[model samples]
Target: MKVQNIRMTATKKLIEEAFTDLLRKKGIEKITIKNITERAKINRATFYAHYEDKYQLFDEMIKGAATELINVHTKEENIWNQKQVTCLTQAVFEYLNQVKMSCPYSYQNLFPLLRMKMLNALKTHLESLFNSNNISEIKEFNILMYSRIIYDAAEVLVVEKTNLTYTEVIEEISEIILDNNQSF
Candidate 1:
């Protein structure tokens, strides 16, 4: 059972890497199951066994990446703080930067999907933080609002590729959150 699980994991990783490579080279719209299977060196049946279709593969990849980012960034603490927020902002910026560099041609095509996935991940993390902290003063809506605010602010820096340092961006985001928290 353990060996089977490891093999399945390895196969999925290979398929995902192949999909990413094809996405970088040919963009999402042009890539097909055949392209992915050829790149992955896997049969169509194996691909179908893992994913129903290309859309499912894409979505699973995005969600997996999002979960990974969240896990890596939030490994230490459940409470939200400026430092954690800074780390999250920097991690996101770095991730986006890598995506831009690696898939310059497909970055624009992939940005919307990446943005939505990242935002959902951020929101999930923030909700967990809020719930764990037992911040009864802040409403659920406010937590959602703050999550969007943090995501949008960081996203602007990422999309613009501003010259601002991560620390500078972090400071700005901290202020935004602090100011908003005061109101709530």
Candidate 2:
């Protein structure tokens, strides 16, 4: 059983790596199951056993990446504070930059879908932390607004090349967030 699990893990990794390679070179629409299996050096049956289709694989990839990206900045306690907020904002900027660098073609092709997914994920993450604190002073609408502000700022940081250094961008994000939000 353990060996089978290991083999499964290895097979999934190969499929994921192949899909990612194809993503880096071209859009998902151009990538087929045959392409992935061929690139992965695996049979079609193996790919089907792992994923139902290319869309499923793509979704799983995006979800895994998003979870990892969010987890990197999440605290063990999920505490809501200025520092936590800064970390969350920084995570978005850094993660987007990484994606842009590693998968420029995929990033360009999937920017809209990526943006929506990232935004919703970021909002949900922030909401969870905010809800945990149960701060009566900060309303739910405030959480939504704050998440948008942070996401929008982070998006700008990734899209534009400004003179502002990374620290400066973080500082600015923190300032805007902290200034508007004092309760958290």
Candidate 3:
């Protein structure tokens, strides 16, 4: 069973790498399942067993990336604070910048979907932190609002090419969120 799991993991990695390669070379629209399977040297059945479609594969990849980014920037079990918030914003900006570099041609077309997925992932992470910290008073709406504010601020700083340096941007963001000394 362990060996089977290892093989499955290897096959999924192959599929993801193949898809990314195709995405870089020919963009998403031109990259079909057949193209992915051919590049990955896997059968259609194998591909289907792993992912229902290319879009699902893409989404899974994005979610995995988001999770990794969150883990790197915001430690698990940490309560919400100015540093954590800034780190989370940094993660979002870094992830989006990576997407831009990874698929320059498709970035514009994929931005909306990528933004939505990233926001959802960020919200999930925030909700986990909020829950673990016993912030029971915080509602789902508040979580969503906080996530949006963080995500949008990061987006503006990254995509808009603001005059402020990264450190300065994060400092301002931190001030904005932590100004009232409101407890998270």
Model 1 C-alpha lDDT per residue in residues 125-174, reported as the tens digit of each score: 77777778888787777666766676666667767767777678788778
Candidate 3 stretches with Cα past 4 Å from truth are: 1-6, 131-137, 181-184
**Native-vs-model 1 lDDT?**
0.77
Worst 10 residues of 3 by lDDT: 175-184
lDDT of 2 by residue, 1-184 (tens): 9999999999999999999998888877889999999999999999999999987887777775665678787756487666776778777887688778767776766666677777777778877776777766777677777777777778778887788876777777677666755544
Candidate 3 global lDDT: 0.83
Q: Pairing residues by index, what is the TM-score of model 3?
A: 0.79
Over 1-184, each residue of candidate 3 has an lDDT whose tens digit, in order, gives: 9999999999999999999988777667778999999999999999999999988998888877877887898874387888788889988888888877788667666767788877888889988888888988778987787788788887786567678987887787777665667555
Regions more than 4 Å wrong, model 1: 1-10, 161-163, 180-184
Residue 117 shift from truth in candidate 3, angstroms: 3.2
Off by over 4 Å in 2: 1-3, 76-81, 181-184
- For each candidate, the alpha-carbon lDDT, in order, equals 0.77, 0.78, 0.83
lDDT of 3 at 182: 57
Superposition TM-score, candidate 2 onto the true structure: 0.79
